[model samples]
Target: MSLARTLLDSAATTALVATMALSAPSARADEKVSIMVGGYEKQIYLPAKLTEALGYFKDEGLDVELLNEPAGVDAENEMLAGAVQGVVGFYDHCIDLQAKGKFVESIVQFSQAPGEVELVSTKHPEIKSPADFKGMSLGVTGLGSSTNFLTEYLAVKNGLKLGDFTSVPVGAGTTFIAAMQQDKIQAGMTTEPTITRLLKTGEASVLIDMRTMEGTKAALGGTYPAASLYMQTDWVEAHKDIVQKLANAFVKTQKFINTHSGAEIADKMPQDYYVGDKEGYVKALDAGKAMFTPDGIMPEGGPET
Candidate 1:
C-alpha cells in the first residue's frame, strides 16, 4: 500500500519531526534504534514503556532505546533532525505534516481515542463549557502539539475564535500540574495519571473528557485515533525489517494492555510512573485503559474524523 494510504487509512498517531538522511538502517544486530516518546509516563503513550518493561523488543531481536520528551512537537523536531528513529505520540501530526509536504506514517495505532481530558480548575466553577473559555488561558503540551490542536478544535466548534483564548504550553505530568497549581492556565488538556492527580486533589474537574471512545465521540464527533508508533515515511521504506519488528512488539504490547488489569499493567511500568501514588495510578489506568485498542490497528474513519 502507498505510504500515505497506510497512514490515512489507519488511526491517527503522534507529532512532527526533523528531516532524516535515509542513512543505513539502525536495525543492524546489536545496534540500538532509539524511539522518542512524547511523555512516556503519560498513560496515552504507555505502550512504549510497557513494551520495554516486558522485554518485547528483545523478543523481536531488536535493541531499542526509548527516550522521553514532554512535548510531542519537540520530539517531532528531534525525529526530523534524525536524532531518533521514530516517535510514540498522537497521530494527527502525520496529516498536518502531509499537508505541509512532509511525510510520516503511523506503523501501529495504540489507541482509538485521544486519551486526553480537558480539565478546568475547580476555582473556575463558572466555566461550564468551551463557550466559557473566553479570556481564559488554556494549557497544551506545546504551542503546536496535539493537545493544542484539539483545544483549538473544541473552541472553534463552540463558536469561539482562535484569539478568544490563550494556549499555554504547560506540557504534561508534573509540569502540567504545576501550571494548574500556580494559575498559569485556567484549564488545559492532558492525559492520565496527571488527570487523576488533579482530580484527586480536588483542584480540577473534567470539562470535556476525551479519554474513551464514547467520550471522544461525544466531544469530537467520533473515535479520534491517537497514541501510535510513527516514523518518517522514508525511514519506514528504507528499514522495512526494523519497522516490522517494531510493529510486532507494539502490537504485542497493545494485546497485553487489553488482556491485563490496570494493576497488572502498572506492575510492569517503572515505579516513578506511579507519581508516588500507586493506588491512584491503578484506578486511573483502569478507568482510562478502554482508550487503548485491543490490537495495534487504527479504528475505522479515525483519520477522517
Candidate 2:
C-alpha cells in the first residue's frame, strides 16, 4: 500500500473508533445508587416505589436500591454513612440535617401536604380546636420529628405554652395505636394508613386535619412539605445529571399517580404496604392524593398548614 493511502486509512479508522467511543453507553452504567426510606412499604414512600415498579429509574439508566429504615434520623444516618445515596422523608429533617452540617439537599418534593400527621382523639370530642390541646397528652413519634415540631407549633399558635401539653413519644404505627388504646395518650399524631385504621376501629377521631390548616397552607401554599427526595450535597454535585434524571422520574410517577384513582394506586401498591384495611387504604389514598403536587417543587416556607 502507498504511504499516503495507508495514512488516510489510519485517520479514518481513528475517527470511526472515536465516534464509537463517544456513542457508547456510559461507564457509570454499573454504578448503583442507594435510596433510603423511613418505612418499609408505606404509602409515604409511594413515589419511589412507583418509580421502581414502573421502570422509570431503569428508563433513566439508573440502578436504584431502595432501603427502608425506621424513619427519621436513622434514615439520615444511613445516607451520611454512604449506605445510601439518597433519602425520602420530611423536608424539615433535611433542613435539620443541613443545619447540623450533614450536607443533605432536597432533590424533589414528594408529599406537598401533611397527609398523615394528624391530631386524633375520641375522648376529647369537645377538643375541637388547637386551644383544646391545652392540658392534653399528645402522642408524638419522637422528640425532634416533624410530629413533635408540628404539635408544638400547634400549641404555640393556640395561645398555649409548650409545657401545657405533654408529648409522649409513641414510635409511630401500631405503637401509636397501642398507646391510644391503653389510654396512654389522649391525642396522637400519626400518618395513614394507620390513622385510617384507628379511625375505622373507633380507636381515635380526627381533631385537626393538619394538611388543610391555615398555618400549613401559609407555609407551603396549601401544600404541606411533608416528604421529599434528599441526597448528600456532595453526591448531588458530583452527579448532577443523575440527580436531575431521578427527579424527573419521580415527577413522572407523581403525575401518573394523580391521574389514577385511589383504587388504582391501591392496586399498584403492594398489599403489605397498605396498613389500613382495603377500605382504609382507599380512604387514605383519596385523602392523601391532594397532598402530592404534580411538579416536584418544594414550596417556600415548607408544606402548607
> Highest TM-score among the candidates is held by which one?
1
Model 1 lDDT tens row, 84-136 = 98999888987777677677888888889998999999989989999999999
TM-score of each: 0.92, 0.81
User: Number of the top candidate by lDDT?
Assistant: 1
Reference-based lDDT, each prediction: 0.85, 0.70
* lDDT of each residue in 1-305, candidate 2, tens digit only: 54334323322322332233222343234578888887655566678787888887887688889887745667777788888888887777765665565655667776766665555667668677778888888888777767777788777877899889898888667888899888788887787777777878886877666544353565334545677787776787788667766766777787888799988877877787776478778877786777776666555434223
Worst 10 residues of 2 by lDDT: 13-22
Which parts of model 1 have CA positions greater than 4 angstroms off? 1-30
Error of 1 at 195 (Å): 0.7
State the RMSD for candidate 2: 12.7
